[model samples]
Target: MKSLSILITTVTFYLISSMYSYAQQTTDQIKDQQFTEAKETIIQDEREALKVEVEEINNRLQNGSISKTEADTLKNKAAEKHAKNIENRLIILKNTLELADRNGDQEKESKTGIYVGWDEDANDFVIKTSVKRKKEKKEVYDFRTKTGVYLTWGLLDLVDDDNSYGNTDVSVGRSTSFEVGISQTTRVFKKSNFLRIKYGLGFEWNKLTPRDNTYLVDNNGINTMEQFPSELRKSEVRFTNIVIPVYFELGPSKKIESQNYIRFSTQKQFKIGFGGYGGLNIETMQKLKYREDGRKVKQKIKRDYNTTDFVYGVGAYVGYGSFSLFAKYELSPLFENQPIDKNLLSLGFRLDFD
Candidate 1:
């Protein structure tokens, strides 16, 4: 009876030891698998975050908001993150190889997944997995009118030696003029938006101040400059016009593409344009501000003054950036049926804004 009890106790002890060892081994296997899965998940999440960051940096570069050097720095950081991602993947492979060696699992060694290795040229790790990406579709925009506003202030003068407005009495310095305009630009070519036709409406004011105390006078449908009576401080002839201008503008342009639209980029360098304009005179006036009878006085007279009711001109511009050199010469005479035939000319610069 004693031998039987002892034998039963030893059997129970051996079974308990075997069961405990099996449970512990199972728990260890579960832990290792969970650890590997958690690591893979972390690596994947990190790689996705790096991809998002890299895209943002690339956007800044294309938008011209960041310098090339800054972009390169960001790109290097992204590469480093990519290298780290590869390293994490390789670590899983290395652990699998070791686990296979300890367990004597030849199949795991033979059929291992995701072969990752070092790439010396790239200074990073390379994955042997191949992934195919879908090609990006391009979105094109319909032709539309692009508009801009410009402000111009420049010198105004009369051209032609015979029509020099009564022998340089019209001081060029005092003939400063101003113009404001709105322009609509249309692309002339579908493939190349660099060539464009621009047409717009503008308001111009030209002031011609005469020297030697001279002022303009109208007599019998004729315009002439006469000496101002009394000690005149200043005298000027002013004309206002509403003009329509057409131009063939040419320049180098870049395409700016968004997700849903594409358009030509704005370029401010090395632009050339030739155009013509026609307009109607809105107002013509002469002003004389002088001291009479030892008192301050002013005279403003509005008149036909034989000035041309309609005017047309050809002009050209060459520019770098917003500042441009511009020249315009009128085809029509300054006055209609005048005693002297004169033509208007102007040279100036314009500041453009979108």
Candidate 2:
């Protein structure tokens, strides 16, 4: 407690002495003293800037962006640069001080590291900093991967096992395929964005409408297409699937880089992707509409119908910016066991928003 009281008494006397010293100064005398002390402040500021530069270079070295030798060289160059700045600025400040002492008056204007001077044109006293540190801007958009939702619709055509395209059973205009999902695209390389990997999860729909008055008949465990005894207005089979699609995309992007960050943009850029999708069939449903006993009747049935449970397909797309021409062909057989083995193919337009 006695030591604390002694410290308080000492501080009180120091404050009184400082106030007395401040009282003795005229405006011109105070300005001269302040101008002289600014030399030390400038030197200290340059040294501090040099330290910050060294720390930044060390960070690059630790991150493997620069080698140790390069970091050392950068550090040395920064030190030399600050040293030279200190020398040159001190010489100028010393010359100005000597001129002021010889003239026995404060200078109206003088070039120093930090300057407080009278501006004749502006008719005012101005302060200026000769040394300035560069500031880099942070990018507003900065990501290697982009995510968005996608929707697709297309015409579906069935192909027989022996035939590459076309089937006699399903109508081309009546059959349709659709997909909706979330998607992501990522850059494949550290320094290049020309190549990317795109992947997504989606729900798939495949619909087939039979031609003529024929309907699917399940006899025991065997299924076949047969004519219905009753007149039929519509007969169709719909398949729902959950799928994961992946693609290797090739494209060009606009790159903007600085000391702060690197950003890649695909705005108005053309891109092409080739990939495949695979997943399990969720469910299959059959719908029939016909006249029974002179009254309209509709029937719905849910069954596997020996259809393949595993759904897989190859897909390709070419586009500019947000829209693309897309095509996909199903590789798995339509049925696990059937008289005619068939596959499905679809072509349509797609939109991706990111």
Candidate 3:
């Protein structure tokens, strides 16, 4: 009876031990499954975070606002994170395969596939794709036009054989006079290689100073006339002319492709053109004399040298953005049948627009 009881007790103890071992194995398997799921979750989260970071960094780069160093740093950080995430996924995959092998479960082992980490090359590939897209979207323009106002000063030369009173005179001066005027220019045509026209009106002012001298006889000595000097005499002549100028321009069409403070953006902004002009010039002259009381007397010899006629010229203009410099030589004389011959030559600067 004692032997039988001992046998039964041993059998019960063996069954309990076997049952406990089976339960512990089952628990371990469950833990492994949970760990694998958790690892996969962590890897997926990491990949998603990496994708967000990459997008943010790419946006900053495209915006062109960040410094070069900052962009490079962000790129390196993203690359490192990508490598780490790949490594973690690869480790989890290897462990999963090893766990399946240890359990000798053919089905689970067959199901366990290797996790290839996020492709390192893919980040660079995406960046390159974005860069190519941006490059394809750049734009370019062909032609442009602008205009503005201008002021000029030039020397006027007179060439005639007439005096202040329209009389034949070796007594009058034939020196070049000074002139000044203002105008506006507008561009009419523009092309890659083409011609342009600019038209504007100007007003010119001129003055001529004569040279001739006469002497007066006195009891004590010869005295120079106060108004007309004994050695040198001079007459003052003034003229005002209204002029119109047309400029023919030629050059590259893409001169003003870029935006700038100057009206145009081309070195070839300088142009040479023929100009036709028509206007009225009012001319007057004055003579001076000395009185016995030591006072000077002034007389107007010619007040209405007013003439309406055509004035034309050939000129050249050079421009730097909105600023321009010009020179012109008149083809016709200021007056017809005058005592003196006069031709107009002028130099001046102007502001232009389009």
Which order, best to worst by TM-score?
A: 1, 2, 3
lDDT of all the models against the reference? 0.71, 0.75, 0.48
The C-alpha RMSD of each candidate to the native structure, in angstroms, is 17.7, 19.4, 21.6
**Residue by residue across 3-87, what tens digits does model 2's lDDT show?**
3245334433443343333333322433655553554465556756766787788789889999989986886677667666766
Cα lDDT tens digits, model 3, 138-231, are 3454334444455555443433333322232222234333333444443454323346666666676655454344322122332112335332
Error of 3 at 215 (Å): 16
Q: Which candidate wins on lDDT?
A: 2
Give me the displacement of residue 85 in model 2, in angstroms: 54
Ranking by lDDT: 2, 1, 3
Q: Residue 220 of model 1: what lDDT?
A: 75
Q: Return the TM-score for each candidate structure.
A: 0.59, 0.59, 0.40
